[model samples]
Target: MNDKLDLQSTDITAMNIDKIAVLFPNCVTETAEGKKIDFDLLKQELSTEIVEGNKERYRLEWPGKREAIVTANIPTTKTLRPVREDSVDFDTTENIYIEGDNLEVLKLLQESYLNKIKMIYIDPPYNTGNDFVYKDNFAKSGGEELFESGQIDEENRKLSPNPKTDGRYHSDWLSNIYPVLKLSRNLLKDDGVIFISIDDNEVHNLRKICDEIFGESNFIGCITWKHTQQSKNDERFLSRQSNYNLVYSKNILITKNFKFNRTEEDNKNYSNPDDDPKGFWRSGDVRSPNLRQTLKFQIIAPNGNIINPPDNGWRWSEEVLKNKIQSKEIIFKNDNSGIIRKIYLSEQEGRTPENLWDGNVFGTTRIANSELKELFGDNVPFDTPKPTGLIQKMAELFRTENDFTVVDFYSGSATTAHAVMKLNAEDDGNRKYIMVQLPEASDEKTEAYKAGYKNICEIGKERIRRASNKIKEEKIDKAKKDGLFSEFKDEQDYGFRVYRLDSSNMQDVYYKPQDYNQGTLDLFADNVKEGRTAEDLLTQIMLDWGLPLSLPIERKTISGKEVYSVAGDSLYCCFDDGIDEAFAKEIAKEKPLRIVFRDKGFKDDTAKENVKQLLKQLSAGSEMKVL
Candidate 1:
């Protein structure tokens, strides 16, 4: 099979070609009768480079355990219930108010929502001289001592700023931020972007860390926003009035696709003084250096005056000029101003945006705070919040109506969401926001706490409520004055849905006889009161079944008892009370794929046996189990 057939020159007439073809029929090829086959042409076409194939590689697994096992001396179990009913207005609106550790919330969101966010704007703690420090204790010993010593106090939390004198100041800050930034990057889509608001305290470090996470190629330019009108505490040098917004993109090419919206002022620049049939007109130079190289010519005005063209050349050639003169497409602005040409707006191309951001178009922080105060009366809890106009401008630049998702992880006072709502109110855009904030207790020493605010989350929620109310009020007042909404009565235009963060609903219910005692019953009772309804326990069972958590749940009264069924097509359960024969027969008649019942809720062993038999006879495809 590996033998070489022929190498040196061979005489085809001397050899019996037909006999040789028979000997190696598959390898031989014959051309049309009496036509010569060009072997050289075939060889030239078939010649190719031989490249080495890539090798198959295997990853080595670590021999040690991937996670550590530490004895938790104190109880750290928490109960998290859905706050949809409590908040009432949440989910129907576009805003979100999350209360918990942002890190944990971000992790929980990894599965259901990776690569789904459009934009993420975070204003994390600046790590100033007296700024609050977050204590990260992922793994610790003496949990009881830590809990009892008020280390994890719900009311009075710990916040020790990293002093410059501390040896691990930078290390501590990096440790606090690395995990969050890593997770936040996962939430961004391939075309998503991030805007980080930071001061001089850690802007440089933040950029380096972001580069490592989002790749240096994705680094967008930093925007310098004029944050203050006047700067104080100037001894020698001038006080800085601007703060930096570090921008980066998931992909630079994707971000470049974002278009800037033109304002009415920009549109007014184009005028149709000549009344050219092309809608609007503007003046443009009639010379070019690159595109019209061959168009250089001297122009003789109507007054018989000769005019020299630009150094480069005229924008059109003599042939093109003769064609325009015949068509009357070219017009001189007036008899005076050096014969300026008219360029119609319809003929003009769209302008690309410049990098420089104007403070007048957006606004300063003083104006932002004043606006906030006007909306929420004097002495608002939030000290510094971005103006709604600033965020609205960003939205106009990057987002379109009903097309983008905006996220603000460092949602101080929920200003980002407020801005999104305001923009949507104007243009009816469906931009959604996901806000994450640590439940940091408000400082008693600060005026915010003295105003009766408990934590930053409380202040954020209240701000959203007040902003929504104010927007509605303004809309109503405008509608009344315009006589457009006199018959409407209610003219509210803004609403929001709020969600809090917590642990997974799954809990191991299996316990040995020896482990069932008063303490276990007490724990179970506490879980029941914490809004852990029968439906909640059944959801835990569904998790154990490896079913999707978003399965549809239906409640039905069977045999004078409530039963929760998931998917309504399979997995029916009666967890409320004693299961009766009539209910079992009815469930069997429905013919679900799987049926479950509470083991302790059956009237007798006969009732359970009757259910199993009925399912086997009438619905042979069903499987029954007890919890």
Candidate 2:
């Protein structure tokens, strides 16, 4: 089986491989050692589509492009380790903060999050010469270097700064970004969209890859945002004042249509001046820019004067205009120049978010910096954190429903998390956010380190805490003023569960199960590694079973031993030592949809054999699993 999928998920790659094998049986031969796919044979089979020997086909080439390709496909025995101390509300919250290499996190998320994410937004390094990029060397993981990036050998594992002085400056950045994006695409829902914030440094390069990965047809509009108003006098050429969000949908056809969340400012345009019982009303343009000779008709003014069609003619036909006039839905200008149509506020769903955004609507960089200083007691740690307002706009644009998941692999100062909370408070949305940030060490000389923030992840988590509290206080004031205290509940989650990508709780022998036998297992005694708790093992199992880690957990003593129930008995688990058969039988009585047990926790073969049979009989159709 491909490592990405649990028994629950259908591995698309595997499915495709099977489909290909059905058409060409000879191309399905396995490698001599590992039963891996023979890509050479597959390429030979698909000779028509295959381009080789310096053909004139267009392709995006970089020094390390092949290595990046290999990086995403390489398998790992890694798992997410629960860090309850670092978390705010570890058990009850839906939001999660993952501290690790994003590439690995992307891999781990494949099964549980596949076709589940509603939207994604990331602001990655822009290849600004001094910026650092992740280098994934597959050879270091003991696999043959199937791909090559001229930068590294099979030894080192570290992030290096891609200096502009290097010959392969752009190539290095492409190598860094390509694989992560390819892997991230697997997690997106069919209608899911991704918004990447980038500047001139890598916007063109990013766009090229996005077009390739998401397909040119699925490309959404590139939104240009005015990030700042002040001119940088130090620039030698034209001063940079804006950034862009390259948007793309996983599959555009599934979206039905694009929409932006209706904002208060958008609704404020309507007023009930001469209300005809349609609530608040605003004038809609009756004339469109589309030319249609059929729609070019004259209309009689309220004063019985003739009014001519607009430059491009009318948006409605003469019949529709006559019906509007009869229904009292048309408004005439007091100056007797033109007529307008009524657009009732109650009928409006949302306005289309235009491609251009000014600084005033979404707060500028200056405002973001000021916000940081205020939250951090005058200590501005991050250099160019985006304003929450800006990210909120993007979130609202892609959010077609009230509840959805948003993942940000490059969550710098947790501004995106702040935006999620703010939007939720404003509209009572149940949006969940997942923030992944590498624990990039903070510079010792910087104010962040001086303020006791040891790494970027620390600063980001702290920002979320501060932002959450501030939003809560503001909401309390609003509720008090509106006299809606009784209607509001204080139970909403403003906290997150935290997990770190760490080595698996299982020993090396467990991953390399082929090397171990029944006698070897006796010699090893305990399969789980030392210094790992039952909870840690439980978390790894949860992920392996394709269960979400954010589900609420309930621990109880059944038959005088510990057992865990997740999300109200949807899944049951017990990883305790010397677990009794009676306890297993008791758990099976609940008949949860899924159940898990430690493979070695049983007293002996008889104990294990008895419960295995009892569980099968007691809980038919349940997904029974063992660690």
State the lDDT of candidate 2 residue by residue for 1-627, as single tens digits: 237745576757667766876887666533212123456667766687764544445766556667789988997679988888988977779999999888888988888798998889999988887765646433344333321332342234545676754545777678779988998898899989899989898898899898888898999889899999999999999888999999999998886466786778889888988857879998888886788888788888878889999988888888988888788788788877888789998887778778888889987999889889888977788877989999888777754576988899999999889899988888888999999998777777889989998888999999999988998888888888999977977655788988988888887754376877778877467778889887888888878877877788888888877888888878888877676677768887788888887778887778887888888888886777777
Model 1, 1-627: lDDT tens digits are 349877779866425544543554332332322222234433434468543343434421111112111111122333223455524243234445567676656655554357877788887877775564756343456655544443553323344666754434555566567667777888888878888888887788788877877888999878787776676786378687777788889878776455566556667878876566767766667777574556667767667666667777877887886566566566543462344666666754344445555567677787778777876678778887888777776677663435677888788888887888787667767677767776666767766788897777777777777777777777778878889885745423355444555444434465788889987876654233344567556654564464433345677876688877777757887776567677778777778888777665677888878878878998899988876
Among all windows of ten consecutive residues in candidate 1, which has the lowest summed lDDT?
A: 62-71
lDDT of 1: 0.65
Pairs in steric clash, model 2: none
- Score candidate 2 by TM-score against the native: 0.80
lDDT of 2: 0.81
Q: Relative to the true structure, how large is the alpha-carbon lDDT of every model?
A: 0.65, 0.81
The C-alpha TM-scores of every prediction are 0.66, 0.80
Residue pair clashes in candidate 1: 90-497, 90-498, 91-497
Best by TM-score: 2
* Positional deviation of residue 239's Cα in model 1 after best superposition, in angstroms: 2.0
TM-score of 1: 0.66
